[model samples]
Target: MLAVIRYSVPESQSQDFIKQAHVILDTLAGEPGFQRGRLARSVDEPNLWALVSEWEGAGFYRRALSAARMAMYPLMILMVNEPSAFEDVYVSGQEE
Candidate 1:
């Protein structure tokens, strides 16, 4: 499943957020079902960031995300959305 997570960090906490962000990414990467992950920043909204990840399956994705949610609650506002439909396509220009 493809999971898309969007979150906002307060301006004052940006540095701290960046510092702690790796922990979450690393934890997810170590999970058995985790496939890939990416971090994104908005072109217009400076404080907004996004996390995009894929898992081996739906159940595995849910479990890993739930655990990460609990661990990251104290940091900032978090919003997650996983669309029920997705397709994995590899463009010639894209690298895995």
Candidate 2:
């Protein structure tokens, strides 16, 4: 499963946003079922950022959020309000 949270940040606030994002990523890393996570910005639109994470499953991801909610809340508040969770239906490089 994947969890992708998008954010619209002004260039002036990009540094601070990146810092807080790193903190949240670090906090979530300690939780169970966290495969890996990445913070990315859209190429054409730098203000458009995404916090992407892969998990063992939706349950694991939810549990991670539940466990780290407090620590991540501050940064999470900056995320765009929308559906962020996704199931892995296909992957190009991996064998089925």
Candidate 3:
């Protein structure tokens, strides 16, 4: 499963936002079933960012979000525009 959180930050607060985002990523990295995660900034819109993470499944992802040690929620709630989860529907060459 893929989890993505999009953030809209002000130009002056980009640095601070990035810092907090890294902390969140670091914390999630240690959780069970956390496959990989990355932070990306929009090329056309500098203030836009997305925290993308891959998990083993939806259950694992949900558990991580509710974990006691997950301290990034507050910061996330402040920054995130819309967060969502998705299941893989297709892959390149998979239909061949």
Model number with the top lDDT:
2
lDDT of 2 at 32: 91
| Candidate 2 residue pairs in backbone clash | none
**lDDT tens readout by residue for model 2, 1-96:** 999999988899999999988988998898899999999999999989999999999999999888878766776657799998999999999999
Q: TM-score winner among the candidates? A: 2
Each model's Cα RMSD: 3.7, 1.2, 2.4
How does each model score on TM-score?
Answer: 0.72, 0.91, 0.84
| Cα distance off (Å), candidate 3, residue 76 | 3.5
lDDT of 3 by residue, 1-96 (tens): 999878887888888888888888888888899999999999998888888999999998888877724566656654665557898887577774
The candidate 1 region of ten consecutive residues with least summed lDDT is 78-87
Decreasing TM-score order of the candidates: 2, 3, 1
How does model 2 fare in lDDT? 0.89
- Can you tell me which runs of candidate 1 are displaced by over 4 Å? 76-96
| Model 3 error, position 77 (Å) | 4.8
On a 0 to 100 scale, what is the lDDT of residue 26 in model 2?
A: 92
